[model samples]
Target: MPGFVGAVQIMNIGSSGVFHIGDVFQLTPISTAKTFAGAGSFNTGETLTIRNHQSATNTFDNDGIDQGNNFNL
Candidate 1:
């Protein structure tokens, strides 16, 4: 079976996000990060694939890093 979309409306697609209309084989969203005052070495990484798994099979879940102010400045 198939479907149709008459109209699509999107207000805001914030940083490191995705917006889709119809069907898609694969999607890779952008990544973003924020740092406090005088904080350095802010970085982020992502992959839509790994091993024999399909790209769509790799979702963005349980992906993050530990942040703190205990670091020596």
Candidate 2:
């Protein structure tokens, strides 16, 4: 479909980030982040720790609602 987008400023974008100005059929995003931290430096034998070691399990079902609906401006 016909579309127009003006000026846009984005600071940061993640691993599964998406930016759309006009129309979109389906936007299914599955994102995960993990971080480990420690107090002292690694040279001092400070062990890195992870508070949460869990994983991500995601599922999606896009039934093709807006599959094709193209139009003019």
Candidate 3:
């Protein structure tokens, strides 16, 4: 879809924009703490991975934080 100003199409109007970080990640630490890319390790209770927007594993199937886990621990 494109909206034109008479003859010129506008650039990305409602896009989510480029990802701030370019790294595939999964939910680590099934219990205590976790990191984005599983760079750190914790007790593994449950885990799921989502790359860009969607995931086949459907991390939401269970009750746990599946996104944005980068605390200064």
Best by TM-score: 1
* Candidate no. 1 TM-score: 0.37
On residues 1-73, what C-alpha lDDT tens digit does candidate 3 reach at each position?
3343344454663332333223435433423334243322234546745345542332233555455536722
Off by over 4 Å in 1: 32-73
- Give the number of colliding residue pairs in candidate 1: 0
With candidate 3 superimposed using the best TM-score fit, by how many Å does residue 40's alpha carbon deviate from the native? 36
Lowest-sum lDDT 10-residue window in model 3: 13-22
Is 1 or 2 the stronger prediction by lDDT?
2
TM-scores, all models, native as reference: 0.37, 0.34, 0.18
Deviating ranges (above 4 Å) for candidate 3: 1-12, 18-60, 69-73
lDDT-best of 1 and 3: 1
Ranking by lDDT: 2, 1, 3
Clashing pairs in 1: none
Record all residue pairs in model 2 with backbone atoms less than 3 Å apart, i.e. clashing. Answer: none
Question: For model 2, how does the per-residue alpha-carbon lDDT over 1-73 read when each residue is reduced to its tens digit?
Answer: 9788889999998877877777888776655444344433233445666454564443343564433324311
Q: Give the TM-score ranking, best first.
A: 1, 2, 3
The TM-score, computed over Cα atoms with residue i paired to residue i, of candidate 2 is 0.34
Native-referenced Cα lDDT, model 3: 0.40
